[model samples]
Target chain A: MKHQRKPCSLEHARFLRARKKNLAIVWALRIGLLVLLLGIWELVTAVGWSDPFLTSSPSRIAKTIAGLYSDGSLFYHIGVTLAETLIGFAIAVAAGCLIALALWWSETLRKVLEPYIVVLNALPKIALGPLIIIWFGTGSKAIVFMTVLVGIIVAILHMLNAFIATDKNKILLLRSMGASKLQILLKLVIPSSLASFISMLKIAVGMAWIGSIMGEYIVSRAGLGYLIVYGGQVFKLDLVMSATCILCVLAAGMYFLVVLLEKVLVKNPDS
Target chain B: MKKEMLRFSSVTYIYHTVRGETEATRGLSFTVEEGEFVAVIGPSGCGKSTLLSLAAGLLKPSEGEVTRSGSCGYMLQRDELFPWRTIEKNLYLPLEVSKQNSPELRRRAKDLAVKYGLGEFLQSYPPQLSGGMRQRAALIRTLATDPDLLLLDEPFSALDYQTRLNVTADVAEIIRSEGKTALLITHDISEAISLADRVLVLSGRPARVSYTHELDFGDLKNPLKRRESAGFSGWFEILWKELNQ
Candidate 1:
């Protein structure tokens, strides 16, 4: 006699519904916190308890953003910054994965080249802004170079660690079954290192933004960073705060994009 | 003598560190017969894993000759299935490695999965399956290459007790049905008594064979039923006493 398994319970359905409700509650709380902070800032300025000139009231920042939007400067600056960040981040990811692969393939090369990488990573990449500007001459190229410099070493280190940390027994098992080295690398090592690589990309997104902004601050005619510098030079605290807010929003947006990519890659990693 | 599926003649292995050397297996010797299910039971740290490693050619014997008639398949303590791969793709791993990626071979691999109760979960990843199903999938992957011998290095040690019994029965059925020889290294005496035709007991580190018991549990073919046989506890006690000695 063949035994048939019982159907799943409605209790499981109820549990899943409750979990979705809890998730909605948490997201609502997060938005509420942001609103509360903004309201407090507006109230403080209206009561004359805080100087709107130095701190730049939320309403003034919003109006400044609206004015820039009406005149099209806001979109232009955003476009410039976004182009620099994406190009630099793409180059960094490619170069970083290639370097990690090279290091993993050769122990002697890794040992010989490791100290140089350490030295390069230790040097403050912000200091390279002047050199990059001199070489690439104050355009997207310099900003991209700076972003790659800031982000590549961290990506290489993380990916190499992930490759080396794969299960040794599985590798041995494959080898014992007469698998070639390339087969082991492709079938076992790379797939296992994917979660780590996605995490490194998230970190690189933030570092790339930092590098781009720092480059702009040192030597650009236009960008969010340039707007901040221009506002400071002309003593318009409102413009400076508005640019800072834009940068924050852009960075948060990129971080969330990477988080979405990670969700797709690992497909429910740790929930 | 079934052409001596594997022969290890006077093999000795030593673990060397900066401080010194510690011997794990001192001039141990054994042979596995073709299509035979052999279980190796020993005390803790008695180099059971070392023996499997040597047989798999992962480690060369320090002092003796180790020869195998055909290719080997090794299953580890953990399932070691890649989380990113679907069950069907995982089953094709060995075929992929051996450059046997033919459509017929892939179809046969799928048939094996279907026959082993993984038909519905062919597209599922390792994380989506239960522990026993994962183990079954792993075994199917191991058998996909049709290797001459299987080296099981405590494959059930990671499973809970109930899952262990169920998986053990499934594995025994699979090996017998597929007509493959297997060498299982286990610390559990009853496990050895129930699943294996012959149980080889070894001493503590620097291990050597202390006793070899041939078991017969009547007409019973199922592992659980074999465990219920009258002679089950008797063989277990004998193995326990031999391990203690």
Candidate 2:
């Protein structure tokens, strides 16, 4: 409060207005770039510079989406992928934090499991496609399993780093107060590691989407990912392009949700 | 007759690091009597912090015994208030840690916040408060646990000169008003003189008590007032010479 110079209300108002104006300009520019790219793409194919069949234009993708909507498959595919991703994101974050806590609590367990966790993280997850299908069968379960597998290791690593990086001084203060390990973890470690946890969730969102789509690419009867594979097989390039576009929007939407969660959870989020 | 609250008898501490061993303190002995405010002054890196750490049970002495009559509350150089918690919640940390989070204790903590002029800021985060207020809140947090003694480790050194003067006075007043014995480890000669009933000067590395002075500024209450008292600079200069030696 002493450092606060206490700007005049009029000056503060002007500052806020200028910031809002800059934010509006930024959003406009982002949308404008997306529109400009779409326009160029459409123009290239509309003028016959590129083959429309080979390189589907934005209008074609839009038309393909409309066709899927009318047939009621658009929502169905979106719902399938969205459900898998959200479920996987939740499970991975929870399990990851819990496993990290366990690893933190037991130094020996962390030592034994750390190298294996690193190996699993390094392994190409898509290579597990056949084993996953055989174990969970060609269903949403296999896709969900794939999603969890892709994200859990990264979650554990990031969260473990956060838990271990809690301030030594604060830990000492708590210990001096006769705090038990469980109390220390609950009061000090978990609350302070919130930023790391939120960032981990943000990363896991992308991994969940990738895992679900990879699973669908290997074996799936539905989901936008399945549509992409089916469209490729049938040479419906517009369908593939449309499904890919939807995936982009879905991933962005999930990322936006995590950002909002960060805003809600951390009062002073490192923006 | 004053009762003895804490005693560190022939305590020696040796820090073990990758570079080998460095002796911090050796044959260090002192006693804090009930209701007494004692300050220890030494040169920088002369194991002032190590001594407090040993007393707080964060580090054990390599030799000899450290004895205490009751629970002790430790205040660090930095006001380590949890950034995520509001002021009121941060004050509850020790109570929560000790499994003493009763409704009465929470109310008393809130009352202490209000009594200490932090009523309006009880719901604010630590970052939102001034440095002085944060330190006050930290002291209140240490007080909330109702420990038999308080160990303050250069608690006001991080503040600006003006804030440091004001905060030390305020903290000294609070500790005195609460009737708690305190062991303050500081490098400031005047600050050590103003707040403490007795000042102990320790020599550099392999720290042990080199000199002791019993302050007798009768009827001087606050730290600010103590500086205004007669013979304040006399005690300051004497301790200054002792510390520099």
Please provide, for model 1 over B18-122, each residue's C-alpha lDDT reduced to its tens digit, 9 standing for 90 to 100. 999988898788889998889999989888998998998989988988999998888988888888788888899889899988999899889989998999999
Best by lDDT: 2
Model 2 misplaced stretches (Cα beyond 4 Å): A1-17, A268-271, B228-230
The lDDT values for all models are 0.88, 0.92
Number of clashes in every candidate structure?
0, 0
> Which candidate should be chosen as best, given TM-score against the real structure?
2
What is the total number of backbone clashes in candidate 1?
A: 0
Off by over 4 Å in 1: A1-29, A269-271, B216-221
For residues A25-141, what per-residue lDDT tens digits would candidate 1 score against the true structure? 999999999999999999999899999988888999999999999999999998988888888888888899989988998999999999999998899988777688889998877
The alpha-carbon lDDT assigned to residue A124 of candidate 1 equals: 92
- lDDT tens digits, residues A4-97, model 2? 3666688877887898899999999999999999999999999999999999999999999999999999999999988987888788888988
**Candidate of highest DockQ:** 2
DockQ of every candidate structure = 0.55, 0.56
TM-score of 1: 0.90
Residues B1-61 of candidate 2 have per-residue lDDT tens digits of 7899989999999999999999999999999999999999999999999999999888889
